[model samples]
Target chain A: MRFLLLVIGILYITPVLALSPPTGRVLLTLTGSITETNAGHTAKLDRKMLNALPRYSITTKNPWVHQAHKYSGFSAVDLLKLTGGKGDLLRITALNKYVIEIPITDFTKRGAIFAMRKDSHPMSVRELGPILVMYPFDDDPKLKNETYYWRSIWQISTIEVLTSPSKE
Target chain B: MVKWFRKWLPTSKLQHWYVYGLLSLIVTITLLASSILLYSYNGNQATKQRIYEDSLWNALQFQLQSYRFLNYLVQIDKKDLPLNGAAYTQYDLLMSRVDLLRSGEVGYLIRGLTGGRTVRLLNIITGELELISLNLSKIEEGDLSYLQDMTTRLKQLDNQVNEFTILVSKGTNLYIARQRRALGENLENVRILMMCFLASLFVLCCCIAKGFSVFKINQRNNKQLLIDIQNIHEEKAKILTLVAQEARPQIQALLGVPCDNTESSNSIKESANELLHTINMFTDLALIDIKKLSLDITTESLQKNLDDYVQIFSSKLQRKGVTLVSYIDPALPDVIGLDFKRLKEIILELLLNAIKHTPEGSISINVRPSSLTPTQQPLNLENRRIGILQIAIKDTGFGLEHAIQDTLRASPTTQDNQPLILQNNIGLGLSLCYRLVHLMRGEIHFSSEATSGTEFWVDIPYEVSQSSPENISLYSCPDPKRALIFTTDNHLANALRLQLSSFNIEANRYLEGPYYDDEDLDLVIIMDSNLISPEIESNIKQWQKNGTFVLYDHQLTKDVQNKAYAAKAQSLSFPLTQSRLNGLIMDAFKTD
Candidate 1:
């Protein structure tokens, strides 16, 4: 019976263990690009580096359902700055190879945060956690369209510095 | 498809709920989809960077292993070299194999892949591998320096790769964190959106409910308004029926009793006449009085009609012994375009009121020339003019009270205390008269006093056509001592007598007869058709040689004045003015 309890505990704790902050020396690069406010800056990020940054979470209702759920992430601005990317457009890629570009300004204007947790717990792959991009879509109805929805990439594993020309 | 949906879901049923649901769904979907995309993208990017780092590390490891093999070969002993063919062959084969492996691209990695102590270690390893594999005995000084240079190049390549890998790794971590955070936020937003949508739908439903309530209230109001209109229509119909019933009996009772036995009928007729007179007087007062006004009247038929009107009005008020005194001016203009019937109604109404109030007093109708600017003059062939007249009606009966006088003067409306229906006949009559006066663009003034009684004076403007020149160019000069006698054939003698006190002319009266009189007279007027007779024509011819004798006819013919002038005599017609008479006298005196 003791052994059986030990096995159950391990099964439950394993996922929690996996969720601990990644610890190591993180390497990163920086690039100069335009931001949403038409300001130029550099940004870059890595796994080890992101784990070292500040974290936060919030609960809110989403477009698809009436139930509210907790979301966790870092400030989108801090994450972009680590990547050394100053472009208005940030192209994020997930481990599953899904790619999407988000406006960097959407982060600064709306207090947008880049998160890695949900309900105070590290997000799992199925939960679209590990990495997710978000904006304060609750404050405005304009974010309810598919354009903004499609721009939020999840399970993010990498970010590339795509040299974008300034449109403004 | 939409029509089918409305059949069951009928927007009216769940409009509010549906709106909220739609809003919530839209918000949540957008946020969730965006978060998923960002998370997946960050994950892929991180994986790619990791793979590339691994590839670099593996490449470096492979380079190091090859260097170790080279070092082992270099450490081989030349002193214990193979003395026989078999041993030499073995050694040579080993050396060749080493050369084959170390040469080309793989050899270059081993040669250049260096960083920190790793570069020196590879150099040592490669030298040892070459010596052992190739059986070399000693190393040249020049070769030693070259080997050291290889070590330096390897060190540089290792350093570069390490720096690049570290930078890329840091970038990957940050990007992943960002994607993760964004995903969380999007999810939160989606949740919030769902709530908002639901709330909006609730509001929409409330609005629809309110709209329905409003529609019901409006319908109720419309129904009430329709009922009110029906009630008003019914009330008007009932009033009309009552009026007809009352009027029929009163009229029959008034006339039926008169047509009975002879003696009673006569007595009844007298009373009836009195009643009729009172009724007639009321009718007259109710009508407008434009016809009673005058202009230079050449139409005698209109005078006869007015006389008939006066007689009718007088007979109705005999009970009060109310005498009607009329003084119609002969020079008044003929009333044209006037409603004679309405005029009679107004007069009759006034007469009735006078008779009713006055026990024994005269109601005088006086007409005289108005002092106001006369717009019409009587037709006068002699004076080239016409006359204008004004009329005033006064009652020597119960005088108008101060209050009535004030009202009449202030508003041009006269009210008498006479009752007719639910209202007063006098009030209606006065209001009608006031309105008529305005319609004719005339003025009506009221003058009254307790002692002298009340008077209503109407002023009407008129125009007349005369049988004279529109513009006169008479050569006749003025003379105070002489006059021109003009006559019409109808009772010329009597007509002359009516003018006895009117002109400053000597009587030159002569019927149709021989002229055996004064040959030195200043003027002579002939009205006899005998003026057209040969004997009279000759006499007038002889008379014109010594004096002036004017010939006129009953119907003053056009251009007759010119004919008289051609005959050297001044001819005048009836209705001649004093001024024209003076002018004719002056002309006659000029030749006297």
Candidate 2:
């Protein structure tokens, strides 16, 4: 009976461990001071891997939108937990070479998200999609100014954690 | 200018003007306060509107930026560049900003500015965003053909958003300008209200000052008037004192004379007494003029007083050959509230006028109870009996001329014309008579015909006195006496002889030039003498020594009466009464 109980426990724990290894092409990369990784010293995530980290949906207006649209993603804090990323500042880079520096505290405080889908659909490259860094601008009045809006990077490619303060 | 102002200015009417001004001030203040409150409320609403408009403008700016970014993404995709996830994210962001602008405070402000134009723009933008979003999936799959169509639609929306933003900005500026102008007008109204309040205060001060000045002037005038009245009173008192002091001696001498029954002697005495009474009435002229002569009303015989007054003119009437007729109503009260002295003067004045004017016709006086003249009756006597005693004096003489009659009826204040009326010798006595009648609350009427006569009727109000008349009979001498009389005047000597004969006393008259001794004389009578010579005085003494009684008529000065009394003779005044003569005869006979 102890053997049967051990098998059931293994069945429940297997799927969770299986979700940590990315099978599709890597869309997001996390580097520096990381404990968990899908490959080597850095943590790299595909769409399916990022989705497996606690999903949430939000509707908000931003500087780039004509109407409020629904964005489905995992919170930045959840993604950091999945990669075991530890840092005071995050340097994010988009595919178009657009870069922004954000405090790591903003991830938890402002409900910052790594958006994978807009209006319930997966984002394409031409749509500034695949991954986007978004803050809930409409929900929080303090995040509505230019500082937070500029920090919300679109078409994000990589996140580098740094313990040092940014020059800007 | 001063006279015109005096005529037109509301001098004593300031209170009414002040009340009206105060009421208007209160109403104006209330109106101004209410206007200020309403203006402040309007200003608050304007501020709220401006805040809403500013929020709407910020929303439009955001929507424009989102649309521009979407267009940039589409351009990048058409250039065969890797957009990554930019196109879909930009499209979603543009849609979200457009959705926010369509509702909430921004929506409300846009709707207020262009009615439904903003909503229509929003609908068009929304429809364009939905179409672009649908094609977003196709473009992501490496399909670059839809990029041009999406860019064209986004460019159109950008143009429309820019136009709507300008419209909203212009509309907001105009609204702000209108609000500013309204606030300025409200301030101007407040300034006008302040000026009006100051003006009202100025007018109220002027009215109060004017009223105070008028009150001061009235007080000064009243003080001056009081001083003038006091001076007039002092002057009147002095004149009355002079008249009373000068006329007292003559009046006392005349009152001492005894009255006799003989017509000629009685008329002489009556005329003298009337002259004294006239002077006494003249002394009281000031009192009568001021209406201060109160009646000393008492029970007295009006008929008897009238008879005495009538007798004063009898000798003149006799000499003028005018017949005298008199009548008295027996039913009239024997005693009534008559100021006897004033009434006697009134009768005497009328009688003298009649005697002076008549040539040969008869003069008559009639007394009776009669109705008061229409003007003389008091208004409040509806339930009470008002007794009026009418004394009418009718004379057949050259009637009073029209002008003289007018002067008689004229008010006494017209003293300048009084002397003119008296120039005819008729109005002086009648004027005096008229004043006396009026003083007694009486009315006098005169009727005349040019060639015939004039008549005066005086009606006086009286209260009947509750007293009976006294009856007194004349006394006669018990024995006839042989008496000697001495006088300087023939009329007086003859009057004395006639009066002696009525008492059956045989008397012989001696003129002033003679002296005689009679052994059979029982009494000696001296009529009147200012001074007696030593010879006449000795003769009076010799008659006293011969057991004869002497009686002297003292009509001269007080010194002459002292001399007569020093001679040890009984002296009597002129015009002796029957009772006095009877008493004298009884004393003389008792000595015998």
- Please tell me which predicted candidate would have the highest TM-score against the true structure: 2
What's the lDDT for residue A65 in model 1? Answer: 25
Each candidate's number of clashing pairs is 140, 26
Chain B TM-scores per candidate, in order, are 0.30, 0.39
User: Per-candidate TM vs. native?
Assistant: 0.25, 0.32
lDDT of 2 by residue, B412-527 (tens): 53332333434555544565666667667677788877676788898887655545543223334567777777655443444456556655678777655654644466777765
Residue B252, model 1: Cα distance from true site in angstroms: 8.8
| Candidate 2 Cα misplacement greater than 4 A, ranges | A1-168, B1-227, B250-275, B289-292, B373-386, B401-404, B407-432, B469-592
TM-score for the A-chain in each candidate structure? 0.65, 0.81
True contacts kept of 2: 0.00
- Residue B367 error for model 1, in Å? 2.6
Instruction: Name the lDDT value of residue A58 in candidate 1.
Output: 57
Q: Tell me the tens digit of each residue's lDDT in model 1 across B172-244.
A: 4554567568767855765665566556555555555665665577678879987885576456545544554
What's the fnat for candidate 1, on a 0 to 1 scale? 0.00
